[model samples]
Target: MNDEASELKPSPKIDPRLLELLVCPLTKAQLEYDAVAQELISRTAGLAYAIINGVPIMLPDEARDINAVTVAQP
Candidate 1:
């Protein structure tokens, strides 16, 4: 496949309702979606849960520390 075709391939999309339903496992706080990173960020918990193949892996052990993530400023 051509590079353009590969770039155009659709990525798995998470359901909006599911995003609303999920929370930070450690803090019980609401999560913010980092669509570009495919992660659910929990500022309160200082962790980011990964979204794989449209499924959210909410396990704390599977999460990356939010402090380690560098978000670009708009």
Candidate 2:
């Protein structure tokens, strides 16, 4: 398959309600969806949790540290 086709492969869909119910395990803070990256970012915790097959891998060990990713203030 071509790169475009591979990228378009169907991934599991996460429910909006489920997203609303999920919080950062460490901080109990809300998560923002980074759809293109397939991650759930917790700004308060400075972590980005991976979403595998549409299932959020909420484990702290599986999350990437975002301390180096600077956010622009309004």
Candidate 3:
């Protein structure tokens, strides 16, 4: 495959151990991995943290509010 085509491929799955260790920074609750969306869902916190290039972006400011409600500032 060409470089461009290769670049379009999905990122490798995140380490299971790392996922087990991760928690929602806001709620300190367990996270659910959504591989299809490349996000870590925090149902308690109503947020979805994006996983970029196999790395989870845990920053609340960078997270997307899955519930459509405002994420309070820290």
Looking at candidate 1, the ten consecutive residues that score lowest on lDDT are: 6-15
Give the runs in model 1 whose Cα sits over 4 Å from its true position: 1-4, 69-74
Over 29-73, each residue of candidate 3 has an lDDT whose tens digit, in order, gives 999999989999999998999999888999999999898866699
Instruction: Name the candidate that leads on lDDT.
Output: 3
The CA lDDT of each predicted structure is: 0.89, 0.91, 0.94
Better of 1 and 3 by lDDT: 3
Ranking of all predicted structures according to TM-score, beginning with the best and ending with the worst:
3, 1, 2
lDDT of 3 at 61: 96
Predicted structure 1: lDDT: 0.89
Per-residue lDDT over 44-67 for candidate 1, one digit per residue giving the tens place of the 0 to 100 score: 988989998888899999999978
Alpha-carbon shift of residue 49 in model 1 (angstroms): 0.6
lDDT pick, better of 1 and 2: 2
How many clashes does each candidate structure show, in the order listed?
0, 0, 0
Stretches of model 3 off by over 4 angstroms after superposition = 1-4, 69-74
Judge candidate 2 against the unseen true structure and give its global Cα lDDT, from 0 to 1.
Answer: 0.91
Compare candidates 2 and 3 on lDDT and give the better one: 3
